[model samples]
Structures are given as C-alpha cells and as structure tokens.
Target: MTATVAAPDKTRRLVFPFTAIVGQAEMKLALLLNVIDPKIGGVMIMGDRGTGKSTTIRALADLLPEIDVVAGDPFNSDPQDPELMSDEIREQIAQDLPITITQKKVPMVDLPLGATEDRVCGTIDIEKALSEGVKAFEPGLLAKANRGILYVDEVNLLDDHLVDVLLDSAASGWNTVEREGISIRHPARFVLVGSGNPEEGELRPQLLDRFGMHAEIHTVKEPNLRVQIVEQRAAFDQEPQLFSQKYQQEQIELQEQLIQAQKVLPEVYLDYELRLKISQVCSELDVDGLRGDIVTNRAAKALAAFEYRAVVTVDDIRRVITLCLRHRLRKDPLESIDSGYKVQKVFDRVFGLES
Candidate 1:
C-alpha cells in the first residue's frame, strides 16, 4: 500500500500513478490480477461516482511495460505470438517476408456509451472487397483493443446486445465480422474492465456472470482518508511533474513486479484440495456455471504469482473468492444476505476456515 507515482514523461500526458492512488484497494487488486492473467477473464467494477475508477484504470495501463508489436500493424499484433498476430502479419510470416518490430504502450480503449455495433466490432467493407477482390475490413475499437485493456465506463447503461458482443469477443479472444459472405477474423483479446454506479442499474446476471471478477467500491468514510485523497489530487494537478517524480522509483518497482508476476504465473501451483473446496463453494452457492470456479482458481494462482510464490495458499483463495464469485450468485428477493457475505460464508464452511 505504498504511495507510488508514475515517472513523468515530458512527451506524454501525465496520469496519476497507480500506487499513488489512495484507497480503493479491491478495485486496484482486481485490476492487477487481471493484468497478470487476462485468461481469468475481465473485471466488472461497481462503485459510486468520483471513486477514482477511471483514474486507477488509466494509471494501470500507463504503468505496464511496453509491448512488442509488428511495425505499422493496425491490430497491435504481437510480433512473436502467431495467435496474437493479425492476418496481414501472419500472411507475411507465411510468405517469409521481413517483419519490423516496434514497442508501444499498452492500448487502453474506452467504449463510449452511444457506440454502435459496427463501431465497437468493426465493419467489413464488402464493396471494396467485391470490387478489388480482397477482403477489405475496417478495424474498430475491438481491433485496437487487442492485447490491451478495453474499458467501458457506465457499462450498465450500454445496450444489452452490445454488451453481449463485447463479452463474446472477450471470452473467445477473437472477433469475426461478416458482411455479404465475406468474413474477417482477428485477435480481440483484452482485459475487459467495466465500471458503473449501482444506481444506474445492473447488468443482467447472465451477462454479469461472464466477467472474471466483480469489485464494489464506496466513497471513503474516514475523514482523514478523504482529505488525504483530495489533497493528493490537488497536488497532482498543481505540479504534476514534480509530484510524479516523488514516487517514480516505486512506480518502476511495481512495473517490474507485474512483469515478473506474468513470467511466474505459469509455474504457480494450486493444491488439489483447494481446488475441490473452491468448486464446493461454487456448487453449494448454486452458481450457474463453471466460470465462477475456474475464475476463482485462476485468480488465486495469479495472486500467488504476484506475491512471488510458486504455490497457492488458502489465504490466496480467501483473498480473491469473493471478487470471483459474488456477482455470479443467484439473487433471491427474500434473501437479505449480501452477495459477498454469502460467498464468504460458504467458502469458510467448505474450506474449513471457520473460527
């Protein structure tokens, strides 16, 4: 919980540092874990206004190490991974053509509230394809978001159909757009982060369940913390470069930590008993699908990896289970128990952690 700041780059717009942001630990942790392992799916964050949701997310994107992409590629195609490469890049490889590699900051795409299906998913230019005898496709937000973070602010207000399309692409890791019998497919893998105020209305449980984790944040209740957050923001605004330099070392350390965690994630191990108990909690809670269990396991392993541990512990599961399963729980009109509390209660019983 050290206060860390991003190094000031005179050429780039300044963002409030990730570690420098005060409070909202759950939101921050969920985002970090997603970064460590995008296959855990994405995070759905519900919080009040002015909760620093957008700021924290942007800071995280800025905090990440730059990625190697094929030079001049529109999809931000990974130079080494064929699965992450665009069709053009892959075709070049097939033809044994030279490929240039370039480094770029991780892409962060914001899905605007009024975006159309074509805008979010991109469109196939059938006229150009038929006339030129080539599959001419115009990439959209999803294409730009590949191998990055796709953020949707006020996601609950988004059209349900659009949400479905986003979730599908996120889950499948590819987007296929078709028009006039011409189909275009490309990598669309990203850590989907959605934040909205609860008062705006909630995503349908079916759709909500698709997210890997759900984090709920509230306004800081302590007066001192609130004052501190306000002061930090003011200071950041007053002399952004000077303020950022203060915590630049911490930011670099955190960035290295994240990169190391990603490298270590594959070696992290989850115990069989812990896995059983995780599913037991999911089953006992009557969670609809295997996503809850799968996400909890992945999240726990990611947490262990982040802590530089090769083995997952009960504490790791304890830390992430609520975020992994709370939103997936079935809502009963008569039940007064909080979703997080209910998930924890079952976890304690199943994992034998009751005191």
Candidate 2:
C-alpha cells in the first residue's frame, strides 16, 4: 500500500527545478559531492519544513543517470560484469551464468515514520507457505534500496530499532536476516539520505554519525526570491509540461556535468599538508572520533572533482567545512556563529582560502 500525505492538493505539487531554486547553494553543493563520492557516508539535511529539502532530493533523482542492475535481484546488484561490479561481487556472480540487467533511476525509497518492523525488514512469505507449503523469503525496504538511495523524511522520529537496522546495513553493505525459519544476507549498499526539522527532535548521535555529510538550509528570505519561487511554482501548476520542458534542457546539462565529475573523482589528489589542516581544525573544535577528518577529506575531494580539478585545493576544503563539520562539533547553541566560521578563522591564518 502506498502512503499518502495529509493534504489532498496534488496538482500544485511541483518540485522546484534545481536551476530554479534560489539560495541554499551550500546545501546543493554538499548533495552534489555525495553523488560524486558515495563513501562520504550519506547526506543528512537538517532544517525547518518546506525548505525544499525533499524537493532537492527528488530533483537529484531526475538529474542523475539511471544505473544498471540485475533484472530480478531485489538488492539491485550488478550483473557479472568485471568492470561494473566490485571485485568481490564480480567473482560471486562469475559462478552464476546468464546474468541480466536493465537501467533504473537509483531508487529513493521513502521510509514512512510509522512503518512496522516487519515492513522495514523482510518477513517470510506466509502466502507462499500456506498455499504451496514452500517457504519463500520476501524482501523489504532495505533490499529494494540496494545500489540506490533510502530516504527518511522525518528521520529523527523513527524508532531506535529501525535506526539500528539502518546503521547495520549501511555500515556492512549487507542486510542480515534470521527470521521466521529463513536466514538471508544480501548486498544492501545504498546512499542513506535523510531530512528533518531539528525543532521536532534530535537525531541519535550514533545514527547521526552514519551520514557522510550534513547540510543546513532554510526557506528563502529575500522578498524577491520568495516571490520568484511562488511565481514560478504557480506558473508550473498552470502548465506542468511546458514548465518542465523549459527546464528539461538545463537538467540534461547538469546530468552531463555530474557524469563527467564521477569519471574524474578518482583522479583528484590530496596532499599531506591539507590532511594535517583538516585534523587540526577537528581537534581544535574538540569533535571526538576520526570520522570528522575522514568526511572532511572526502567532501573536499568530491568538490575538487566537481570543479574538474585534478588536485584538491584549500578553496575546496573551506567550501565544504561547515556542512561536513557542523554536526560533529561539540558546540554551545548560545554561540550564534557556527563552527564552520571558527574553522574558517584558523584556515585564514594557515592557508588563506578566503580574502
């Protein structure tokens, strides 16, 4: 069964085009980096509601290239192609013959807040057993999201148990099951995407650390920008196809850029001086755990890749500091200034990315 939102006003629902979205440039940049490097963990967007969080994610889905996946595999594993699948999976599939595949837009499976445990994780196919006396396992959200994205809108509201499962699968790249007389483990690697209003609740620290990057955003403030958003959105509702068509060419261009960036990412070089700076910033902030340094380095590399540069620059590092380090830092909310700016001060004294 499909979930429905509280509101019935459906025709007016238009995802603001990536090009059309005003402001929030930082948020957009962080998301783009995650696409270039899935190992950056995953992106978690925190902000007030109606800040174009979900819309931005959906827009990315439209912008990204569809990937090839095994035709009947619930986990969306790649077929036995040495170049496409990882060496481990490639070897596993080599023993199996006649693998099949088709292109699919990396799935963005929305996990509803009130979903049952059985629904989130697979359950035995009781229908198959009752009717045919044969035990067949059924897959769940984790399985369906393999090689794609798993999105949680009100992520902070999710139960701890569900969050635990998400962490396990995300860290291991496989979802393990020992339920209902069936044991299964399959590849469940996915980009775990989440968005939430911080006012509602706090995301668990353990789960929060799982995300590769973090972006903070809010609705447009300037009246002109706000007006433009409303005007374009209304125009889109007046004629959906025409509005979408106008932006179609731009989306295609963005897609091409993304493809080029992906191809160039591995070539982006990181030197020792930059690594030392990243560690110094994190250490000064008193942010525990080494994930902060790892994420900062990864995010910087991704930004460099996006810029079509072969070397990661100080400019790239500074551009990504806020989103990558904000949540990880131990800070007092009373301080109006953000940890990113603090890192910035140190950066200017050291490498001078900004004037």
Candidate 3:
C-alpha cells in the first residue's frame, strides 16, 4: 500500500490571528480547553459552511507555542514521555549519547476527505521491502499528529470504517498497524478537531459521544460583527504579514496565558460536592452514560485552570456543561426543543440559575 501526508499550505505565511477572530466564543473556548488539558478528548464543531470553523481551527493551531521534540523522531516523541518514545530512542537516552533535541512547529495535520486507512494509519514501505528485502514501516497522518491536533473537515461524511479507526485511536491514545506481515504500535494521542455541516449528514452516536465537547455555531447575524469579520478578512487578504503583525502582541500574550494555564492545571482541584452536582446535572439531562459527567468534571477543571483559578466552582461547571453534554444527550423524537436549551433547563433545575 502507498500513502501520502497532507502538507501545510506554504502560501499561508501568516495565519489569521486567533485573537483577531470576531465571534464564535464557544468554539474558541473549547479549543483552548483542549489545549490546556488534551485529556478532555477532543472537540466537534458543527455549523454551516463559511462559519469560521476551519479558519478558527487553523488560526488557533498557528497561535500555539512551539514544542521541543526528539530530533530524528518521526512521532515528535517527548524526551520525557518514555512510554510514548520508541525503544531505539530510549536506548540512546540510556547510553547518554549526544541526543539531538530540536524545536518544531506544533503539528496541525489535515485528514482529507478521501484519504484511505493506509494514509491515516501507517503502512509498510514497499520500496524498501523490495530493494533491501526488509520490512519497514512508514508512519502516516496519525503518527504525524502525535502530541498535536488532527483536523478533519467534513468529518460526518468520512467513511465509517475510517471513522471507527479514528475513534479507536483517540480513545486508546495509540495506533497499531499490522500490514504486510509486520506489526507496529506507537502513541497516536492527539486532540481531534472535526468540523462538519449537519445538514449534509449526522455523525455516528459512538463517535459523537467520544467528543468531550461540541460547539454549535451559526453565521454572525449582528450586522456590525459581520462587518468586522469581513473587514478583517479583506485586510488579511490584502496583506497577510501586515495584518498578522498588527495582532502579534495579542498573540504573544495569548500564548503566554496558555502556558500559564498548563502550569496551573495540575493544581486545580475538583471537590466531591461539585462532582456530585455535575453527575446530577448529567443525570437530569438523561445523558446515556457516565462519560457526560466525567467529561463535565474534566472540562470544568480545565476552564478554571484557563482562568488561573485554583478551585472549581459551580459557575465553571455551568459554563462547560452545555459543551460537554449537548452532543451526548438522548434525543426525544417527539420534542422539537434544541439540545442546548434542554441542557440549560436541566442545569437550571439541578443547580438553579442563581447558583
């Protein structure tokens, strides 16, 4: 089998700054939360075309701080994360050899719509096998996405089998390839960001449930906000570098905040009472399983950390409850109510609006 990786667009020398995006606060927050605590699983962004879904994702990807990676490692394996490193790398570390370390742009790999399983997951190198009579593995998109974001546009339209593979890898934090009588496994942990148009197709329940948060966005209706978005795009189109330079300071500050949030995340505490409250809200919403409650707890803590707070609060839980449970709730065929509205109703009933 043969495959190719999605290369970054070189034309985009300066991505539209994340701080410059005019609207879609929920989408921005969900991305930021995942960055702070990748254990929050990933985010699913559902909206119509031209809703800034892709733009925001790419901008956020460019906004992130660069990461230190083990040089010559295809997976961007962290030197400290032994479990995620290959045996050869560990041996080099053990030998105290002159280990070359390098800084690399955090990976933001794209999963094109028609990509095959061999492209998403690694495959055997046929050329090396034929030339040298050796079995060698060529890493794919999943490997490239390690310790970074794997973006899938129009995710709902992807092949079901491919979706299953992606879901399994996201949940297990590893991808194992058994091709051409050769077996290989490596850490595939990544923050999965998927954007799709619900009008085209619906995502499978299993895959939907795996997403820690879901943000539903719509076109900006406010005339002024729409104008601001247009003006920004026009400026970006006219002079990408100049437009980026205008927001460089804000971008730097935002990056610093993300770094600080990661440092504070471990110290943020979630108490039992709040945990129980989160469960109560999930239970009231009739969420299918425990994942809703668990995700809410995790997202809340991450939100607090993003705010530089040491303790989780009722407000923190409320802020994230919608994103955590909106996609996980069991839908009522007879009811026309919005899922987000239903989540808010449950929140109000369980904890009250004032609380």
> Who is ahead in TM-score, 1 or 2?
1
Candidate 1 backbone collisions, by pair = none
Write the number of the candidate with greater TM-score, choosing between 2 and 3. Answer: 3
lDDT of every predicted structure (CA atoms): 0.93, 0.77, 0.87
State the lDDT of candidate 1 residue by residue for 275-334, as single tens digits. 999999999999987999899999999999999999999999999999999999888999
Task: Please give me the total number of clashing residue pairs in predicted model 2.
Answer: 3
User: Which scores better on lDDT, 1 or 2?
Assistant: 1
The candidate 1 region of ten consecutive residues with least summed lDDT is 1-10
Error of 1 at 228 (Å): 0.3
Rank the models by TM-score, top first: 1, 3, 2
Q: For candidate 2, which ten residues in a row score worst on lDDT?
A: 1-10
Please say which candidate is ahead in lDDT: 2 or 3: 3
Candidate 2 accuracy as TM-score: 0.86
Model 1: residues >4 Å from true position, as ranges? 1-10
Model 1 residue 269 lDDT? Answer: 92
The TM-score between candidate 1 and the true structure equals: 0.97
Best by TM-score: 1
